[model samples]
Structure formats: C-alpha cells, structure tokens
Target chain A: MDSYGLLIDFSACIGCKACMKACKEANNLPGDPGDHLSYSDYTVVKQQGDVFYRQMCMHCLTPTCVSVCPVGAMAKSPEGAITYDGSKCFGCRYCMVACPFSIPKYEWNKAVPVVRKCILCYSRIKEGKEPACAWVCPMGATRFGKRDRLLEIAHTRIARWPDRYIDHVFGEQEVGGTSVLMISPIAFSDIGMRNTLPNEPLPNLTWTILRKIPNIVITGGIVVGGVWWVINRRMELEKENSNGKEGKVEK
Target chain B: MGRKGKLKNKLFLFLPISLMALLGLFLTFKRFYYGLGSVTNLSDAFPWGLWVGFDVVCGVALAAGGFILTAIVYLFNAERYKPVLRPAILTAFLGYILVAVGLLFDLGKPWNIWHPMVMYNPHSVMFEVAWCVILYLSVLALEFGSIVAEALKWKKVVNIFHAVAVPLVLTGVLLSTLHQSSLGSLFLIVPQKLHPLWYSSLLPLHFFLSAVAVGFATVILESYTSSKFLKRGLELDLLVDLGRFLWFALVVHLTVRWQDLFVSGALANYRPGSLEAIAFNLEMALLIGAVVLLTIRRTHRSKLGLFFAAMFALFGVIVNRLNVSIVGMLSDTQSGYFPAFSEIIITAFLAMMGFVAFFTCVHFLPIFPQEDHNAKAELKVQLSA
Candidate 1:
C-alpha cells in the first residue's frame, strides 16, 4: 500500500514563515504570524533560539483524537491524513484533550464551533499538488512524499550531517509513528515539543481499561444479586419464626 | 403558622433561587447566541473549566449516593437504609439531569448533542460514559417513579414497578460503575499535560473508589440537611451506620491511592510547596479527617459529628476532581485559567435547581419510608437508662 508523509528539516529552515502565510491563504484561515497554533491558524512557524520549527498536526498512525471521538467525527484517511467531519460531532472536545501534541484547536468564538486542525492539505494532495506549506518553502526545508520515502530522507539527512543535526527523528516512532516526521538541528524537546511520549499509541492506555467493563458488570451483578437474595431470605425466615405466621408475604 | 405566613415563608425561600435561575437562563440564551468565548474563560491551553470540572465531574460523584443506597438496600438487603433511598435517587436523577444540561451549554454545537446517539464509537471512553448516563438516568426515573406512584395511590403501577425494581436497580449500578470510571479514563491520554501526581494508569480506579466514598458521605449529608430543613425524622441510627461504611470506603480509597502512587514511582515528582502538592495535600487531609472522625466511637454516634465528616469527605472528592481536571493541567503552562462569572452563576443556578427539585419531591411524595421516629427515640432512651 502507498503511504504519504512530510519530512521537515529544521536545520534547513530559515524562520522566514513564508510557508505559514501560504498555509493561511490556501486554507482561507485568518492571518497571524504567531509561534503557537490557534483556531484561525492551521500551521505556525515557531522560532526557538536560532532554530525554526514548523508546528502542525502529527497525524499519528494510531491517532488518539480519532480513537477518543465519541461520535466518530474524526478518522484517519486511507491517503494518510487525519480528516474530520464536524457535522457528525457533538463537540465533546475529547479530541482537544486526547491529542498528545495538542494539535486540535477549538473555535470557541463561533456560535456553532467545531474542532479545527491541520488536514495536511488532503484536497491539494488529491489533485496531484504538494501541500501549501511544502510548496511555499524556498529552502527545501519541508519535503512531502511517501511515508517510507520520508523516513529514508529523515535518516539520510541525520546520517549525512551527524554534527549538524540531532541523532533522533522526532515523529518517526513517537506515540506510534506520525505521518509528519521532523529532523532537528537541536533537541526536539528544546523547541516546545513533548519528549517523553511513549512509542506506543496513547489510545491503547484508555482502551485497556475500557475493554474490561463487560466482565466487571456481569460479575458484579451476579455477586450483588446473590447477596440480596441470601440476606432477604434470612430476614424472611427470622420474621416468620418471631410472628408464627407467613410474615406479610407478597410477590 | 397561618396560611399567609406559610406563603410568605415559601416566597422568601424560592424568590432568590428563581431569580438566579432566570438570570442563568438569560445568560444561557446569550451563550448559545454569541458562543462560549463570550461567556467562558476556555482557551486552547485550558479547554475545560468550571462546567467540566465541577458541574460534570464533581456533580456526578456527589450524585453517587443513589447507586450506593440502591446497592445497600436492594442488593445487600440492608432494609434499615430504606428511608434515605428515595431522596438519594431523586438527588442522583437531578444531578444527572444537570450534568446533561451542563454539557448542552458547554458544547460548541448544542444543537448536535444527539450525534452520539446515532453515531457509535466503542473505542472512546466518552461513548461509554454517554450511553451509561443516558441509560442510568432512565433507570433512575423508573426508580423515582415508583415513589410517585406510591404517593399518588396508583397501586397497579407501583406493583409493576416493584416487580422490575431489582433489574432496574442492578442496571443503574452497572451503568454508574462504567461511567464513573470512564470520566477518569477521559484524562488518561494527557500524561505530559497532567501532573504526574494526579495522572496514572489507575486514574479510573481512583475515580471509581472516590465516587463510592463520596456516595456514602452524600447520603449522610442529604439526610441530615433534609431532616433539619423539612422537620422530618432524623434517622440518626441509620446515618451512623452509613458513616461507618464511609470510613471503610475512605480507607480503601486512601490505601489504593497511596499504593498506586508508590507503584507508579510518581512520588518523585512531589514538590512540597507546589500548587499540585498543596491541592494533593488538602485533598488527602480532608479525606483522612473524615476517616478519623468517623472512626472515633463518639463522633460516629453523634449526628452533628457524622454530618461534619460526611461534608469533609464530599469536599475531598470535589477537590480531587478539580485538581485532576483543571489544576493538574495548569502545572505545565505559563498561562492559567479561571472560570468567568457567567460560568460560576450557571453552576450555582443548576445547584439551586437541584435543591429546589429535591425539596419539592420531599414535600409532595412519600420519599421517607414509614418509620416511627418517636418509638425509636423512646427505645434509645430506654437503652441508655
């Protein structure tokens, strides 16, 4: 099966934020050159010290936002973008909480708000064009291609310049392999990225407990039911003995 | 008092509540029309605020008295506890209704609230919570409806409800267990965001255990307050026994919490003067205080002492939930969130609605089981002599 992904080299980025502007124009989102992501901004160019990092959705192989959505509003597409349909959403905001990278942004200002996030330019990709951010990068910092190719490119860049780049690829195996991979000149955590996420997907953590509900309910019901019968029966016998009668029996 | 005096008393009581509810309704209308941003202090950094923390989490835990009493009376056949069961169920029913109302206001698209009903997502913890709450509320209705039927002299309906009472109560218990834990499961994902002290793989277990403890405590508080306000039987003996059960529940909760912390090795993150630390200490102190008070023979025997212990336990659970959902998330961020005035007003309004509904039920319905308080008082006097 064909897979798609983005490989961003922070070492090559110039912090120009041209890609951020292009993303805004392409998505028809409001304009603001900020370091943090917001509802009106799908992507942002964050500068930490001397290095520039583009922040957006990771679109995990096992996305917790997709898993935790009660109304099946979010889903991972076959073409490799995490897509969302707000029409089916009840706006529980579990997606905003479940996201490891905190990618999802809420339009709290809107009367009928839904979760907003990076769709990875899935529509542009379908039309045989690169994502707006990738297309506008003059420095060739943001590369878009197949998921396997991106991994190969990330590793090659890291290996080609051992002294210039960090040894690690940020999203290669983080919270189970995100489609948006990153190779940084410095530590990823130094640039506001969470470093301690387990390689395993986070949805599995919640599912582990939720899967046991059926067994607990069944066993708990039987035990409580048994106790009820025994106690009530004993009470009935004691009453009959004392009164020398049926003790106000009824169905 | 004369009829005019009685009317004056009721007006005095309901006037403020009605005003608050109306004000809350006006704000709610504005909230829907203008959006959450206009009213709430929610942001991307802190998406959840007072409504999610208090109205949903704490409110549901407080309502747990219903399921606890149901299990004690119907499941364990503890008939001595029967007098408080109807009131407990009524509290739970109103509590859950308020939870739903809170969600309605909290959601971005309030009109699309029924999406979960049609769309199924088994993987989500919220799906379980939604389904469980909906089903449990229905069960609670039937349970409460039986009381209404009894009061209204509908013997046939009362008999039919009684025939199905066992299954209904059991269903309610199962549903309560699932959702109570699922509320905690909702926070399991944000390990980096939530403080290490509050976050754990065993969060669901902690939530369930604390809810059970809070449930018993709420029963005591409700009964005490009801008797005081409504001039009804105190049922002190039953409340004392319930207080004893609260002690055991609190012990189990504290034991499991400390054990989980130890096993997870999260104690390393404990900073003595940190906000998380202070909140954690306060929560522990309240629960421990309740346990200690209830353990002493004299305190457990006295209604006033039992009331204080129950209040402390309830407060502990409330703080614990808020700490987990809101305060825990604040540790990692430079910016902090506090609820807006509208949010606080709405919460108070809902609480007032619950109090009003509870008393209305007590006034009209045969909620307290037919027990001879005077005879019980005489027996206590005789035993003491």
Candidate 2:
C-alpha cells in the first residue's frame, strides 16, 4: 500500500517552534513551555546551537515498539502513522525498552496510565489534511507527502546543497527505515540524535534467538523422555530378576 | 509442640514478617490510590525501577530451582534427587506468585495485567513470558499438589497426578526455559541502550545457562537453611552431586560468555574502575569461586564450604540480573534510579512471605521422601556414638 512520510530539513528551520504550539492545540494537549515530549505533549521543538530539531516519534517502518508490545498496544498503521491504543495497553512498558528512538512516554502520574507517542496525525491524514506540525511550519522545513516523493525531496535538497548540508538523510535507513526523514547541515549525532543505529530493524535481533526455542524444546523433550524410559525399564528388569532369584532359593 | 512453645519458636521470624507486611500493605494502598509518581522515582527516561528490576527479574531467575530439580528427578529418573523436588516446586510456586504481585504493583493499570492472555502478540517476547509464567505456575501447582495429596492421605488423587507427572514436569521445564531466555530477549532491542558487556546476540543463552547454575545453587542454599533451622542434617551426597552440576553449568556459562565477548570484540568494555566493569568482575569472581570450590572434593564434602559456595553463586546471579536490568541501562545523562522506601518494604515482604510459605509446606506436606529421615537418624546416631 502507498504510504506517506515526513521530511524535516533542519537547516531551513528557524527554531520558532510554531509547529510545537500548533500540535498541542490540534491534539488538545495541555499547553506548556517545556521542550521535551511527555504524556501531555505529542511533539516538541528543541534548539541546539541555532538549529531547531523537531523531537517526536520516527514512526519506524519496522516499528520495534509495535513488535515488543505484549498486547499489540503500539501499532504501525497503513497510513504510515505509529499509533497507540490505550485500551490494549496494560502498562508493561516493554515498548519503552524496545523503541530505538525512546519515543513512547508513559502517563506515570496517573493511576491508570497509557503509552503516548506521535501518531503522525493519522486523523488529519484520513481527512485529507497535513499533520499539524507540518502545516504550521512557516519555512516549509517540515514537509509531508508520499513516502517515495519525500525521499526524493530529501535527497534532492542534500544533493543540491552538498556544501551546506551533510551527505546523509538521517532516518532513511536508520533502524530499518523510519517514516520521519531528516536532512541536516551538521552531523546527526552533533545535534543529539542517535546516528549509529544499524540499518536492519531492532526486532530481528530478538527473533533470531527466539526462533530456535521450538527446536530446542522438541529435541530436549525427546532426549529427556528417552533417558527416563531407559532407566525405568532397567530398574524394572532388575526387580523382576531379583524376584526370580528369591523364588528359586525358596524352591 | 505446645502452643506457647510454637509461638516462641517462630517469634523471631513472625515479628519482622508482620511488621514488613503491614508496612508493605499501607504503602501499596498509597501507591494504588495516589499513583506511581507519588511513590516511585520513575520518569520518561527511567520507566522501570526496583520493582521490575529486582522483584520480577531477580525473582524469576532465583525460582529456576523447581524446573532443574523436576527435570533431573522425573525426566532423567534420578530418584535420589526426588526428596528435594517438592520443596523446590513449592519455592518456585511462591516465587512466581510474588513476581505476579510485583508486576501488578509496577504496572500502571494493575487490573489489566491479564490483557496479554487474550490480546496475543506472538512477536513480543513479553507475550511469551506472560504465557510461560502463567502456564508454568499451573504446572508447579499440580506438581506440588501431588505432595499435598500424599500428605493428606488422598491416595487416589496422588495416583492420578502421578500418572500425568512426566508430561507435567516436562511442560514445566519447557515453559521455564522459554520465559527465562525471553527475559534476556527483552533486552535484545536495546543494543544501543544496554552496555555492550552485557548485551550480546547470545543473551538468551547466557540467561539460560546462568539460570541453570543459579538453580543448583538455590537448591544447595535451601537445603543448608532447612538443615540449620529445621534441625535436619545436611544431605551431604545430594548436595555434593548438585554441586558438581553447578560447577559444570558455571564452567559452560563462563566459557560461552567469554567466547561471546571475544567474538563480538566487546573485550574492550572491561575498562577497569567503571561501575559496569567492577560489577562484571565481581560476578565473574563469584562464579569462578563457586566453580573452584565445587570442583574440590574437600569443599563439597564439608557442608559449611558447600553452603558458602552456593551462597556465592546465588549472589552472582543476583548481581548479574541487577546489572543487566538497572545498572547497565543507566546512561550518564539520565537520573539514576534507587528503590523507594515502599519498593524496598514490598520486596522484603515478598521474600518474607516466600520463607513463610516454605515453612508451612515443610510442616504440612511430604516435602522429603520418608527414607531420608531414617537415613538421617541413623547417621546422627553413628555420629553421636
């Protein structure tokens, strides 16, 4: 299915944070001056040395949070949003460990808490509108379009500004390709983003080990069962032979 | 056997248990009423704290004794080990119950803990863990139930349980192995998050191997404790036999771990003076010490030496689990986590409750085979003579 994606050109962002304010208002979240994403905040804009970086969910193609959730509470939607279902979340927080981006935040203050993260404004996409963050970006730093078209846009910008931009698109291949792409002038790591994530998905690492369990169990069972049978049969035979000897002695 | 005599005998244990239980109850109520932020030091950067790291993870690791003993006694037909099987199963059953209770307290919506049973995410390691723990707990109950039947003179019920004992024990073993490894699998996604020393592709194998060693060590510790307090003499031969197995498991585990480190080029992680390095060294030392002591005939022959070795091994497992769950995950920037007063009190209560349950089972159930008592009495007379 055709999927949508977002591209954030850090060089173009003015650090204004209008996107953050618009997102809070659009999602009906509490207004706060804080620059970190929390349960009450879906997205934020942080400034590091005159560059503004939008911090939110990457909405990964092979979403680790979705795979690690015991109840399928976190999900990757067909519309390219990484959605969350509070009704299915029982607060195990395995998703917290599994997310490569460390995106999912818990409602820790509430007695009944749920995981919270960016949904890429799936509701708006369903209504044929842009995400609030993308719509509010005045410099066109945050652009939303089809996933293929976004990749083209991100690459074209980087190729056109070789001296101005880094020769990389941060999320294009990070942790098996995220829907949130970025083009930055400085190194991704310098701006506090994890740049060393493996190109393959994180979930595959666990699966590689888990896949052997069924084989081990079956083989282990057979081996153990065989040993038990042999030992019991030998003991029974020894008992029978001793009974025969006693009968002969009595005779 | 007198009422006043019995009360006095257990007075020491009951005082601490009652106090801790009361405190734990009060704090637990506050936690549920006021929410996690009012109780724990957890935040977005530190989502998990003492309850998950210590109470649940360490609890499960320590409870591996039941599966190990059950497999040896039933599947391998080592009837000599059968005496300790019931006690092991009882400990495991209590351990799992405590783990479940710990999860309830740690979870934000404690009431929805059962959602995994119906929701069914096969890809999730946690889903496997949830199912395995629930299934294995049932297996332990049934296995321990046979002991209850025998103790209460329900011969027919005992016979029925015995008929299905082999399969029941095997299922327990399978389930135990799955969850124990899955606990390690839980860390697999956090390669960047977890320190390289502890994180490896062989994490699941490391968890399983260490658990096997811990299982044998816990059995030795339990036997030692029972012998001291319950006035029963040590089962010298059985303890030594288990010690040999413990040694073997340690050797295999250490070998594989070092090999994994070498292959992964993570040997550089052993920079001396780092907290992770120190913890890693201490854990390795304990494992090596236990292995050395267990290999020596003199050490295994003496109950005191065996007890120390077992204690060391058990501590090693504890240290390793804590390092993986809490210490290794700590990045320099994030605020460190320390167990709140409520967390510590609840953990102490759970441990106390395990001891209480063990004592109750020993008093009421046929935990040890009858012949061991006769043998012990004979040995005691010979020693006195």
Candidate 2, residues B336-378: lDDT per residue as tens digits? 7777777788778777877788778777665643455664434
Regions of model 2 farther than 4 Å from truth: A245-251, B1-11, B368-385
Query: Model 2 - which docking category?
Result: medium
lDDT of 1 by residue, B1-385 (tens): 6999989998998789789989999988888888898899998877888999999988889889999989887777776766567778889998999898888888888688777889999899889888977888888888888777766667678677877878788888888988888889989878888899999999999999999999999889878866776566347778887888899999999999999999999999999999889999999899999998998999989988999999999999999999998999897754589889998998898888887887788777766543454543333223211
Task: For model 2, report the TM-score of its A chain.
Answer: 0.94
Off by over 4 Å in 1: A32-35, A236-251, B1-8, B229-234, B369-385
Model 2 Cα displacement at A199 (Å)?
0.1
Q: Write the per-residue lDDT of candidate 1 for residues A1-251, one digit (tens) a residue.
A: 36688889999999898988888888888757566799888888888888888899988989999999999999998888999998998788988877988889998888888899999898999998999999999999999999898899889877888999989998888999899999998898898888889999999998898889889999988887888788877777877787788546442
TM-scores of the candidates in the order shown: 0.94, 0.94
Model 2 agreement with the true structure over A28-145: per-residue lDDT tens digits: 7775746687887887787778778888899899999999998998889898998888998889888886788888888777778788888999899999999999998999999998
